[model samples]
Every structure is written in C-alpha cells, then in structure tokens.
Target: MSPPLRNDRQLSELNTPQRNRYFYGKLMDVLHFDLEQEYLIAEQRRGNRLLLGPGVVCGLQVTVIRSGGERGLRVGPGLAIDGWGRRILVPDEFELLPLRLTDEDGVPAPDDDGPLPRQLILSLCYRECRSGFEPALVPDPLCDGPAHSEAGRWVETYALHVHEGTAGDVVRECMPELGELLHKGRIQEALCLLAADCPELPADPCVVLANVAVGPRGALTITDCLPRPVAPTNRMLLQLLICLNERIEECCRHDTVLLKVGAVRLLMGNGPDAVLDSPDERRVIPRGREPLGFEAEFTGAPVDQASVVMDSSVEVLRDRTPVTLPVAWPAPQRLRCAVRNALEPGAYTVTLRGEGPAITSAAQPPDDAEPLDGEAGRQWPSGDGTPGGNFVFSFQVDR
Candidate 1:
C-alpha cells in the first residue's frame, strides 16, 4: 500500500475533528488499528483531560479530551508544537464532543466527587497524540502493542494551561530542574519539582508543572470533572493541580520494571551468517531430500532464559501455494528441523513469525562500563523488560 501524504496544508487545513478522522483512517490503513484494541485502551481505566488549543503544550503521546461544560473549548489553527515547551501555538478548531456520565446499567453515575468515568464515548471530541509531527513517529500499537512505544524509556507528564506569559521563562524554569532530576534518576524529586516552584508560576492564567513517570503498563486517561468556572480561577486551579500531581504519582509508580524485545535476526543453515533482515525476500533450498534449517537471534533486554515459539511457512513464489511440513524453532544454539517435501521448487519464500512473553532481566551492567551517551544509552538496557510482539522474517527459497 502507498504511504500517506505528508503535505502540511493538506492536513493543517482540516479542523481537529476532521484531523482526528484522518488520523484514525491512516492508523487503520498503516497500523492495523482494531476496535478491540480501542476497547482495551478504555479498559486500562485511567482518564486525564488536557485542553489543547492556544498555549497548551503536551509532549506525552496519548488521547486527550475537553470538558464539555460551558468553558467553550477551541482548536486554534494547526497544532502549534515547538521545540521549546512554552510556545503559544494554536491548533485548528475542533467541534465540541459530548460527555457521558452513565454506568453500565445506562443509569447516571453517582456524584460522589471521586473521579470521572473513563469509558470512551464514540462521539467524544478527542485525538491521539504522536511523537513526531506530520507522519507521527510513534510505533503502531497494532503491530507492536501499546507497551512497545515506551518499552525502555522513562516517561514524565504535566498539566499545562495556556494563558499569558513568555514561553522562555517557563521553559527555562522547568527544563533545567526537570532535566537534572531525570538525569540523576530521581523520580520522586522530579514529581515534586512543579510543586516546589509553585510560587514562581506566571501570574494569573498560566500554570504548568512536572511530575512522575509512568510504568510499562501505565495508561493515562484525561476527563472533565471540575466545573468550567473553576478553570480560570487561580485558587481552585492550584488545588486541582496539587490533587492531580498526587494522583499521577500514585498511579504511574511501580516496583517491577516492564520489558520488551527490540530486534530479531534470522540466519539460515550454517552459512556465512547472512542475515534475513527484510520482511520478504527470495531464497533457494537445496534439492536434497532434507529439511531446511535456520537459527535466529532475538535481541532486546538480555535475560537469563527465554522460551520462544516460531510460526513459519514456505510458499511457492509463482502460485503462492504454501508447502506444508512439521516446523520447529531450535534451542538458543540448535537448529530444529527444515523443509521435508520438495515439489517443483524453482523459487520459493519462507516466512517466520516470533512471539513470546514480555521478557525481563535483572542483570546489571559491569561497573567499569563506559558512560551511556547517545546511541550507547539506547543500546544498553535500562533494566526494564520489553513487551513481546509477533515479528516477521521472510526470504526466498530456490533449489
């Protein structure tokens, strides 16, 4: 399938509602989106409501909604995302979405002042955020699972409000302190940074603060609980922010780290270690009456032991008829079995699928290891496990 268009005007011209539809269409086309998975996201059970329009900036990627109360939410022009976090950018106008406050019995939920319901309403006005602009640089949840995007990275979030103030001051104040806390792995300290400097917030209207990182299975859902009038009020806003900070910290922290596989490589029968990197390719199997053997190296968070299952198939390139046989994935260093039957095999393709548990490792790096920098940091596991996914490895076969 052809890739989506990358023109700015083509996308930016649409309002938020339209853009969201476009995003959903692209997600279904490119990422294999499923309604079942959407249900799973809603089932994760946390909600957060972020007002995205003029002056609001969010770096964390997820779905955000507006409180359908009387405050009159607006999507500015286009998403005004910038390098500096404090920019007053405007996104296109989005239509108002309805809020649902009903329980499973279709009855109104009790108003006990606990929190808003996170059950997603199909018609609600919300959009899923991505990492990069234009062609969003986020992993497909369908292909890699939601946990894949955050596999081994630390994630921090904050509540941002658009009001009057220079972006520079806010950036200068928050970035340095937050960066220090992140660098030193001081999670608790980082969550408290915003509250510590509460007195320095830009006068009436502007409010922003940082807090703790989310866990591997962590999910955030934003909702509208506070009244519209309380939004613009300073005293009420501060109280709400304090409450939010405490809640976020409590929800995202955990004892065990989550892990996921980063890469996989396939090598055929004791050859010169030629790697089958592409998803599809052509190869030749010997005409001998023997099975084709192959081994794979699964790289990600190195753990003490892992049990892997492989799904494989060999199909004739011309007619695309799959040749059937008993298949097995070998031990860490052993080859199990290969193709047994050899019909009219001029050229064929073999495809392999890999799946396993979200692998974890408690192994620590050597004390004398070099300081992690740039690519090195990425290569070294952050002592976190990765979520598993079905991976494909394909190559052509010929006699």
Candidate 2:
C-alpha cells in the first residue's frame, strides 16, 4: 500500500471519531480552524480558573430606547472577553436588550420609597450552539467549498445577551474598588476604568456591561440583583488623597505632592524595597556659586516607561521656609531634582514616602507608619482612608 497524497484540509469533516480519546495531529493535509481555536481556548467544563472579562473593551454605548409601546435599553456594539479568553464581539446591529422586572426570586424591583436603593446592572453572557446541522450540511458537488466536508459537530460561541456569571474571582481582585464604583451608580466610570486597566493588569473575564439605579416600577432581572454596594476602605483613602491634594494645591499653591501611582503598582508586584540611592544633600557651598539643583537618588527597579516624571508628593524646604521644587521621578530607582536656582546657604530637605497605601483621615498616623520629618501641625492626607503602612524617606540638607 502506498501513502496517499497530502492536501490542505480539516480532518474533522473526514471522520466522526477515529479512536475514543486519541487527538491525532495533522499537517499540510490541512487542519481546520476548530483545532487552532480549541488549542488556545478549549471548552472545558471544569478546570483551573479562567480569568475572563465580563467587562467591555470599548463602545457598548447604552441607550434607553422608547419606541412607541416598547421601552428597553439598547446595547451597542462592543467587544467583551469571556471566561475562556474568547472575544465576544457584539455586532454593530442595534439590539434592544429587555430589562428584567424582578429579582431572581420574582420579587418586584425596589422603588424609591424603599430604604434599599434599586441597583440595575447589565452583564455579559456566553451562548453556544451546535451549528452546521442545517439542511446545507451536505454540500453540492459544484459548490465551491473545502476539499472535504464534515457532517455534523460544529460549535458556535454566541454572546447571549444573557450572562452565565461564571467569571473567576481574580477578575474582581485586580480592580479592588470596582464594587464601590458600581455601588455609587458610577457604572460608566467603572466600566471605562476596568476596560483601560484590563490590558495592563491581568486577564479579567468578568465584565459589568453597565449599571444604574432602578427607577420607580423599573423592571429587574436576576443579573441585576447585584450585592449591596459599600465603599471600600482603600477607596475612601484614595478619595481623601484627592481631596487633600486639591486643598494643598489650592491653598499653598507652591508645594505640590506627586502621587506615585506607578510606584504603588511596582510595590504591589515586585515587593516594597524602594530605598534612598544617594546620601542626603548637606554641604556648604560657595556664596556666589552658579544656580544648581538638589537631586536625590532612590534605589528601585525600573517600572514606569517615562524617563522622568513628576511626583508632587514631596515637600521641599530651603532652610525653615517652604519652597516649590518639581521632583523628577525617573522611577523609584532615582528621584532627582535640580536645585530651584543655586544651592543657597539655607538647609534644604526633601521629605517623601515610598509606595504607601491611600492615606486616611487619622488624627495620628498608623503605629507602623513612619513619622513625618516635616512640622507636626501640618497633616497631609495621602491615602484612601484605609489604615496601611507608610514608608517614609526624609532627605535633609544641612551644612
């Protein structure tokens, strides 16, 4: 017996089953796209967690449509990732996604009169159909198709406006403040941030399409039955930081503290070992020397892409008086700043903290928090109201 000539074709259409469990490999005698798709993202009922996206990647513009007697929300085209890393592409067609009027238990949606506010949500779902079972399953001899045709056994993954709610926990882990945002009825913002951060953080299969308050007599669905939203401690600390930073900027106008967001991320992933690379700037300079900068180096692994960035969370002082000096954070590894002009005779100090949690509104810093080198009378709300460790690094200039 001689070997048959090889051609490009999918073996799936050829045989129903060769041997129960053996997954025979193929070559140029061509393999179908199914094999490739399954190789990357297989349909396994049970396995390790698949961090999928229930979040939107972009453009699922939601609009409340009221066409004649019909009133429902329309979900525009968008791309949402699924538990299997599959891109559930929402087609560009207009789809009026009906509202769910009751909870999973068939209870009516809470009205404004109730203490518990109504929370409505939109979720992404996955639907699979065993396609190719139609009358066209058998191709005509004249039809221009593949070299061979397989009858039966085709799966088509569809975006079922309905959600299965099978996303892993890691989806919520990366975006710690997601629940709070959704609770605050800041659905759009939450979705946007989640989409923006998804690529950078980790693979998240859980995507909350949208959320809003339930209006009087508003219909509700089981998916809409989200847990009661509560403000996370860390989120509060971040808010405090924003508020205090605005106040400082508005009041003092001179000294600005830079929020080291990147540093915080690096600290989370790589461990917190950011330290001072250079000794404190303390030297007696000639009275008539040319203007120079006061630069300080900090040892840290390079994380941020920018060569230099401003981290305003620094307090610079020329002797006793406060002065504004833009600190250049090339990264935690090196924090440099040229002296605002020549290093005058006055003592200069650069006080900053490492990747600290969102500072809270505490009369006293946490026991583990490093004491501030600056004046005790002044308080800098630097976190999200959560109690967390603060790594203080105070560089002083003394002659």
Candidate 3:
C-alpha cells in the first residue's frame, strides 16, 4: 500500500532513456532530498496542518471580466497548497470564459431568483504531459511539415478547479476530525490524535484556493478571512485567586472584594525600610520584625466571594506552628494576609496554600503511549505541570 509520493530509491541515478525503461527510471529525487525523503515529507507536512499548514504562497488572483455583451473571469498565475499539503502551481494567466450574465441578456431565465450571488470554487487539479522525443519520422519528399513529427514526449496542462460553492462553506473543508474533537471539548484527545498517526486521517487532500462570489449581474465579491490560534492548556490553568462580588439583582454583579497582595515584599526594620535589591523569596535582613506575611501567585480564572471564607481556604504555617492572621481582599487576583505578632526570627519556613480546580490528568497515562519529546504528556497523572486541588508554596523569613 504505497502512499502519495512513494519512495523509489532510484530517481536520483540517471536520465531515463526514450525507448527503454529501468527500475530507476521514474525517481524525481534531488541532491538535497532522496526519494525516501520525498515520501517522508508527506508526514512532515501533515504535522503542520494545525500549525499554519496550508495556504497560497503567492499570486492566483481571480477577477471579473467583461467583453462585448458577455461576462467571465480572469485568473492570475499563483501557487498554493491543498488540504493534503500538495503543491499546486500555475505558470501563466488564463481567462475562464463564460456566457452572458442572467440579467445581462435583458431576458431572465424562468428559474431566476432574486439578486443573490453565484459562488465560484477554485482548487488544484492533476493532468498528464507529452513532449517531442528522439527518433525523427521518415518524411515524404512532398511533405512540408517537420521530419521528426513521429516522436514526442507526453505533456499536459493542469490548473484550477471550477465549481459553484455555497456561502461560508470554504472553512468547513479543513480538518473535520480535529474540528469534531474541539466541538466536543476533548482538547487533550485532539492533541493525542494529532501526535499519533491513525487510519482515520484523510487520504485525499483538497484545499480551497479561493472563494469568489459572483453577483446576479456578474459582479465578483471576494470575502477574505483569517484563522485564529488555539492553545490546548489555556482554559485549563489552575487559578487560585479568590474575589468578592456584589449583586443588584440575580443577573448583574460587580466585584466588591478582590484580594490583591503586593507590589513589593514587606520585611521588618525602620529607616523607611529601604532594601534596594533584586526581588526574590529569600529575605536577607535579620529581624526582630514588626509584621510579616507573604503573597501567593495564581493563574487561570478567579473565584469570587472569598473574603467571607478566606481563613478556611488559606493556611499559613511557620515550621509546624500556625500564625493566625485575618485575611482580606484589598484588590483583585492577589491573596494576602499580615501576621501582626512581632517575631524573634532566626530561621523560619512559611508555607502558603490555596485551592484550585483539577488539572488535565487525573490518573496514570496509558502504559503503551511513549513520552513525547522525552517528557510525559498532559494525559499523565497529575503532578508538577498539572496543578489541581490545593497548591502549596513556601518561602523563608530570613535573619
């Protein structure tokens, strides 16, 4: 079962003879890439589908044309890639001639509807070629034509695919399987499906070159659309932020208390406590401190109304002893509380804990699947990268 662009190991060897053929005859291998690489590029191109895979390289502009009392289209030269990652090239411009427009005739067809437009679909096409070859033909003395007319190499002209398409149908042709997975919210499964090669992948690759809408009287309307990016883990981030919201009714609510921590860490001593140093968790100054507490950082979405339940959800400990301090939300998306009791500090450990949603993985990943890029996938059991439940972070109060 050879796939598209089959590897033959022989295209690099020689120029094929006219009358005779060998095992090496049809290979199209170049110096940089052998026939094997030719076939293997298919996989490389396939992997890029979700990552800017297919589109026009340059040219291929479709424009409306008018001649006498008739209307048609003029297509410009350009290159593009099909959905299957195959290259489509056009070397010369050509006009696609059509009959007079429905309204142009001054006599509309019996089935003519309103001024709705007609769509034109353009894509890649394949063709065969033949050219003049070796041995010259024997010519009669009276014959005026060339003597070598009998032998010719095969050649063919291939280009645009013209079809009438429905409105907004051009985007629907891309990666239907991946689309289905996304619509179902199976993001990890979609990633795995792309990572692994399976039989469900499409065999015939066809991509849209352009979508042109022709008005009822033959005016061309081309709609240009761009694709946006999708990240697998963006929505799954484990944000531990807590906020408070006040409501006027059941429908409308506004933030009342948004817990925000620090722009800078507050360590002890007076003199306006000037510590001009690079910011980090390690505290340099020794302290019989005035007051102390550390801020917690979180990501993803913030939860509301945490001011009433802050103490139960957050925990702070020095070694094994707990420091009781009232927690409040001064601003949004930051959690903080100050321990008022002054301490004789030599060495201390403060562990901060906050609750977040579950991570991407719950249990052990499938045993058969090998680690990708030498790292476990998101499907693995929750541990480091996957943060869920309550997250723990500790910083030392220095002496």
Per-model RMSD to reference: 29.7, 20.9, 15.4
Each prediction's TM-score versus the true structure: 0.24, 0.30, 0.36
Where does model 2 exceed 4 Å of error? 1-37, 42-54, 97-120, 132-157, 160-206, 217-399
**Candidate 3 local lDDT, 1-399, one digit each (tens):** 112333222211122322213365565433223344443444444443433445565676767677875566676786655444445567888675552223211222346444434765554443334366454445333432555343234343455555556424434354789899999999999889777853232343444545677766667665433221111122222221111122234446523222221123443434243232322334544444444554433323343333223334455566656656666555554445655554444344432322331111111242222111111123212123322234333344455
lDDT of 1 by residue, 313-380 (tens): 22223246555544454544332334443334344333332222322233454322211111111332
> What are the runs in model 3 whose C-alpha is more than 4 Å off?
1-57, 67-70, 82-86, 97-124, 133-156, 160-168, 172-189, 195-399
User: By descending lDDT, how would the candidates be arranged?
Assistant: 3, 2, 1
What is the model-wide C-alpha lDDT for candidate 1? 0.32
Decoy 2 TM-score against native = 0.30
Q: Candidate 2 on 257-340: residue-level lDDT in tens?
A: 222211211011123322333232133433444335544332212222232333434555666676665555554444555544
User: Which parts of model 1 have CA positions greater than 4 angstroms off?
Assistant: 1-270, 277-291, 301-319, 324-390
By TM-score, highest first, what's the ranking? 3, 2, 1
